[model samples]
Target: MSFAKVFRTRSFRDVRQALLEREEIALVDVREEDPHARSHPLFAANLPLSRLELDAPVRLPRLAVPIVVFDDGEGLAERAAERLEELGYTHVTLLEGGLQGWRDAGGELFKDVNVPSKAFGELVESERHTPSMPPSQVQALLDREANVVVLDARRYDEYHTMNIPGSISVPGAELVLRARQIAPDPATRIIVNCAGRTRGIIGAQSLINAGVPNPVAALRNGTMGWTLAGQALAHGSSRRFDPHVDDHVRLVSADAARNVANRARVGRTSRDEARRWAGEAVRTVYRFDVRTPEEYEAGHVPGFRSAPGGQLVQETDMFAPVRGARVILADNDGVRANMTASWLAQMNIEVYVVDGLMPADFAEKSSGPSARHAPTPPAVDELTPTELRTLLQSPGTAVLDFTTSANYVEHHIPGAWFVIRSNLEQALLKLPAAQRYVLTCGSSLLARFAAPEVVALTGKPVQVLSGGTNAWIDADLPLEIGETRMASPRIDRYRRPYEGTDNAREAMNAYLEWEYGLVAQLGRDGTHGFHVI
Candidate 1:
C-alpha cells in the first residue's frame, strides 16, 4: 500500500481539535532545529530527523500514542514516518501539507525555541500580576550601589555571557534556597532576571511564594528588557552563588521550599510510589533529580535523570515531551525538588517530590537512562587519533565531521566536510568516490550512530575517529577554519535572536512583540492548560 493509504493524514484543524480536547498528542516537528524554530505551532515538539532513533523511544515511550510529523515541504515527513515504523511506533501520521498547510488553515505560528512555555509565562504575568521593575529602575539601584542583590535565574553559562552589572548566578529554583545567604538582611530587595520573561517571573515569584521577608521583583523583561532600554550588560562576569552553604541554611531553605510546595498542592511520593508510577503502562512517568549538577554528578538515584530545578521549569517540554506525563522529582535537601515541583504543579503537570529517599538509593554514576538504553550501536571499524592522522594524507579518504554547524565553522580538520547525520546518505553521493570514510564528532557517539548508515550507503569501509575532535585537538594537530568544506547545508542549529554578541536590535524588539501577543493567541486557540497561583 502507498503511504497515503497506510498512514492517516492529519490536517491543521484535526490536530487543533485534538489539542482542544486534551487528548494525548505528539505533534512532532521532524525538521532540524533551525527551520523548526523559524515557524511552528505552539505545542509542536522538536525531534530533529538527525537523532530520531535515539530520542523517540524515551520522548514517546508509548508506541501507540498519536504522533503527527510535519516539515516545511522538505519531504522529511515520509522518511521520518518510515523510521518511526522501524522503531515500532504504531500510530504515526504526517501533517497534511506540512507547516505551510497550518498557515493556510489560519493556525497561529510562533518563532524562537520553547514557545509554549514562554507564552504561558506571559499569560502568568497577565493573570497573576507578577511584580516587576523596569530596566531603568534597576539601573538606578545599581548605580547607587543600593541594598539590592540581583539574581540571574538563567544557567551559569548564560549569566557569564552577559548580565546586569552586579548580578549573581543563582538560577531559578535556587532563588528561594539561596536567597537568605545572598541577602542576609530581611530588608534588602531582591530582583531576579533571565534571558527572557519565563525564568525571571518564575524566579521572582519563587522567592515571594517561599515567604522571603524582603521585597522581590522580576527585571521587567530580563536582560532583553535591559538591552532594549539601551542599558549595557556586563560581559564575562564570573559572579556566582557561594557554594559553601551551611547545614543550618540548607535545613531552613528546605523547610521554606516545602511550605511553598504545600501551598501549590504538590504531593510527596515514596520510593515504591515512584516505582509504581514508572511501571504504569498507560501513563508516562519522568524521574528527575532536581539538584545542582555537581551534587547530581557526585551521586544520584540510579533511575533518576539530572535536570536542575531551574532549567526544568524553564524548558518543561524538552524534558517531558508528553504534556500529561507524571513526573517524580528527587533531591537530597528537598529544597530544589520541592520548588521545582511547585512550578510544575502549577503548569498543570501531575508532579511529585520524593520526600525521604535514602542516599543508599543512589549510585555514583554520571550517565542517564538515555545513554544506558541506547541499543548497542552496530559495530564499525575504529581509528585512533594517531592512525587517523596518517589516513588524512590519502587522496581518496574523506573525513566527515558530524559536529554542529557553528563548531564546524570555528575549526575542523584541514579537509573535513561537515555532514548532518540524517543527511549522510545524500551527502555521500556528493562526495568524491573515496576508498575509506572516517567519522568524527565531539565525543564520537553520534559518529558511531552515523557509521552504519554511511557504510550501507557507500558500500565502503567506515571508521569512527576514537575520542573525536577533542582528541585531535589534544594531540596538537593543525585545524582549518571558515566552512572549509561542506557536504550539507548548515541547517542543523537555529541561532537564537536573544543570544550571542551581535543580535539585531530590531529582531530582539520583534521577538518581544511576538511574545507579548502570545496570550491573545492562546485565547484564540484555548489548548494550553497553564494556570498560576
Candidate 2:
C-alpha cells in the first residue's frame, strides 16, 4: 500500500490510547537511537530512517500491519515509509508534521523513556493514584514554604549545569528509594522540577503514581517559570557543598560482599530453603529471580518472580511489603545476587542468593570477592519460533517478548507480547493467568532467567525461547509487525504537592563535622554524593 493509502495518523492521545489498549501498531521514529532515547514518544519504537532495509521486513512479524513512522524535522519519515513499502510492508504511514507535530499536539513524551509504553501506561493508569500538580500550584507551594524541598529530577551533571537556587538533585528513578534522604518530614511539601516539563511531571507522577502520600508537585513550565517569575537561575555553582564523608571502603571480597548480601531483609532465601519455601506447606512464597530484565525474561527457575537487580535492590520495600516474604535472587552467577542478598540482609530485609540460578557475565563484572558476582546461566532451553507460534494458538500459552521495546517493535516473533523489564509485575497483572507462559528475548539468557519466575507468578507451566527470538530470526523465521499499541493515562492536568524523602533527617553534629571536614579533602577523594550546603 502507498504511504498515504495505508497510514492511520495518530496524535499523542491516539497513540496513548493504542498503548493503553495494547494494540498491535508500531510507532516508528526515524531518528537515531541516542537522540531519540533522550526524548521521544513514550510508546514509539525507534528505527532510524537510515536503516530501513528490506531485511527489516524479515524482522517484523507481519508486513501488512500498520507502521507509522515520524522524523524530528530530519525530513526522513517519507523516505522511511517508502523504504518500508519497498520491503513489502504495504501498510506504512508517517506523521504529517513529523516529530514536531507530535510534540505540538502535547503528545506525551519523556526523558529517557525507561519502561515500555504499555508498562509505563500501566504505571500511569495505576488506580488509587493522583495526577500531577499544575505548574503554578507547585511554584506557589515552594514559595510558601522556605524549607520546602524542590528536587531536580535530572542527572547530577545536568543539575550542575543549570538549576534553581535551592533545588536538590535527585534523579527521578532514584526518588523512590532515596526519598527519605532528601525530605525529612511527611509534612514537608515536595516539588519536582526538571529542565523541561516531561521529566518533572513524570518524576512527580511516579511517586504519586505509586500512591506515595507526600504532597508533591511539578514546577510549571519547568525552570522557565522560575526565570519568568523574576527568580534567578543558578549555574556553574558548587556541585557539592557538604562533601562526602564516608570512611567505609568499597570492599570487593566475595566473602565481604556475601556478608553484606546476607544482611538484606528481603529476597534472602538460600538455595536449599527456596525449595522449602515454595512447598505447598508454606503460607506463601513469592519467588523472585533478581537479575537483568533480560535474564529474568529468558528463563528463571520454576516458581520464581522476575525483577531487575537494581530495582529489586532499590525498591525492595514496594515489591515485598509482607515483611517476611520469601525472596530469592536468581542470577547466572553468585556475585550480584549474593552481594544484593548481603545488602538486603544488612538492611534487615530477609533475602538470599539462588546459588545455581546466576546468568552469564557475573564473574567478569566481579573483580574482588566483595564485588557482586554475575553468574552465567545454563544452556538455554528454548522453543523454536514455529513452536512458539504454534504454542500461542494453544488454549493457555502466553508469550512475553522480553527484548527491548524498540527491538520488539522492529521485529518480533509472531504472537509475542511486550513487557518492559523494569515493570514486569505491573505488566504481568494485565495478562490472563488462564494460559501457559512462555518468555522470549534476543538471547536465551533472558528467557532462561525469566521462566522460573513466570511459573511462580502464574502457577502455569512456563518455558523460554531456547536461544531467544533472535535465533529464530537468524534462521529466517516468519514475523509480524503492527503500528498501534497501548496508551498512557492522561495525567498532566492536576497540580500535586511535593514532599521530600521520608528517611531524610537532620545531620547529626558529628556527621555535619565530618561532612565539613571532607569538603576540603574532595580534590582526589573519589567520594560521591555530598551536595549539602
Candidate 3:
C-alpha cells in the first residue's frame, strides 16, 4: 500500500499549531540518532526504528496520544507507523514532507540529542547566572597546587575516557551527596565538569542549590572548553568517590537533599502511591531506580528499572520519551532520588521519589527473574553454536548479526551479514534467497526478538544462535573485521560533536554557538514549559 493511502500526515504548520496550543503531541523522528541529531524540531523525540519495541511502550504509554513520525526520506516512517500500530497505538501519523518538509515550511531545526533539556540548561544558566571558571584560571589553580578538587559530572566511563587533570568521577546527582567527603577542608574549591556545558552547570548548580559549604563552580564550557584552551586532559584516570560512608552521615545528607527538593517544589510519594499511579490508564508513570548500575543489579525495587540518577538527568528524553508523564524515582540512598527529582521538577516534569520502602524491600536480586516490563521473546527455533557453524557452511543458509553498528565494525562471526532487526524485511529483499536463517547478537536475547519477525516476513524457519557471537568466540571461531557485510546503513547511533578526543575545531565552535542560541529558540518554540527555580 502507498503511504499516502494508509497514513494521515501532519504538515509542519499543523505540528507547529499543535505545539503553540500546548496540545499533547509526540513529534517523533523515526530515523536513528545520527540522522536525528543532525536536525529535528525542538520537541521531536528520536524514537529510532531499532528501539521501537524496547522504548515505545515506556515512552508513549497512551495508545491514543497524537503521534507524528518522520524520517529524512529514508522510507522509515511508514514502517515505524506500522510497528506502532502493531504495538496497539491508535493515533499515528506521518510528517507531511518528513524532515525536509519541516524545513520547507520554515520550522526551526535543532542539532544534537536532548536539545530541549540542554536548551533548558542554558536558560537556567542565563537566568541564575551560574558561576563558572575559565579553563585558564582552573589550570592556574592546578599549577599552583592550590587546595582545589575537580569533579567530572559525567558517567564514570566518560570520565575514564577523558577528563580534566585531577578530576574525580562524581557524576551528576552525586555532587550534592559526596562533595564534602572529597573536600573535607571547607576552604577547598570544587570544580565540576562534563564533556560539554549542561551537566557541568547543573552539577555545580546542584551543589549550590543544596547549600554545600565549599565554593563550587563549573569548569566553563566543560572539557570541550578545556581542549579549546589547549590544556592537557588526563585519560584512563581511576580517581573516584569513596563508596563507604557512615549511615548517620548518609541519613543527614538525605535529609538535606530532601529539604532542597522541597524548596524546589519537587513532590514525594509512597510506594503505594506509585502502585496507584501505575494503574492509572489515562497517564503514563515510569518507576526508575535512580541508583548506580552496580547498586541496581545488586538489588532494586522489583518493578523499577535501572536509570542511574546522573545519567537519567543527562539523558531524560532517551529515558522517558513522553513529555507530560509522571516519573517516580527509587533509591535506597535517599539523597540521590531527591537531588535527581529536584532537577526533573525544574524541567517541568511531574516527578516524585518513592520514600517509604524498607531496607529489606531493596534486597539483592542480582540474577533473578526479569522485570515486569521485559519483552517476551517470540517462540522460534534455537541452534547451538556448533550446529550453527555446520548450517553456515551449507549452500542455502545465511547468518545475520544484530549487534550495534560499532561492535559489528569491530568484530563478528565470519561471513555474518550485519543487519538492523527493525529493517530486517527490507534488508532481506536484497539478499539471496535462503532455505533457513540464523540470527545472533551479543547474548542472543535480541536475536530472539527478531526471530519471529524474520519468520513472518520470509516464510522461512528462523533460528536464534544460542548464546550469540560470544559463544562462537568461546569456541575459538574465526571473526571478521571492518564492514565486511552490511545489509543496512550504519545509522544506529549518533556521534556527538563534543565527545571523544578528535572533534574538528569548527564543529566544536559551531556546537557552542548553537547552544548559546537555544534559550532564544526556546522562547520562539514556546512548547517546552521549562522554568528555573
What's the lDDT for residue 84 in model 1? 85
Lowest summed lDDT across 10 adjacent residues in model 3 is found at: 366-375
Residue 503 displacement in candidate 3 (angstroms): 2.7
Q: Give candidate 2's error at residue 518 in angstroms.
A: 48
lDDT tens per residue, model 2, 375-436: 33434346676787677666777777766555666787766677644235666876665567
**Model 3, range 436-466, lDDT digits (tens) per residue?**
8899999887888788788789888888998
> What TM-score fits each model?
0.93, 0.34, 0.91
Report, for every candidate in turn, its global Cα lDDT versus the true structure: 0.85, 0.52, 0.85
Candidate 1 per-residue lDDT over residues 1-533, each given as its tens digit: 55443567999988988876667778999899888888898888999888887788778877777889988987788878888887777889999888999899888887778887788788878987889999999999989989998999999989999999988999787787789888989989999998878899888888888888889999987888899999999999999998777788788888999988888889889988897877777776789988888878888887788899999987887887776678899988788999999988887778899977887877757666663234556677888888998987768789999998999999898889999987777887778879999999887877888988887788888999988998999999999999777998888988777787678889888888888888998887677777777
Worst 10 residues of 1 by lDDT: 369-378
* CA deviation > 4 Å runs, candidate 2: 1-23, 29-48, 51-145, 209-214, 237-533
What residue pairs are clashing in model 1?
Answer: none
| Cα lDDT over the full model 1 | 0.85
Worst 10 residues of 2 by lDDT: 492-501
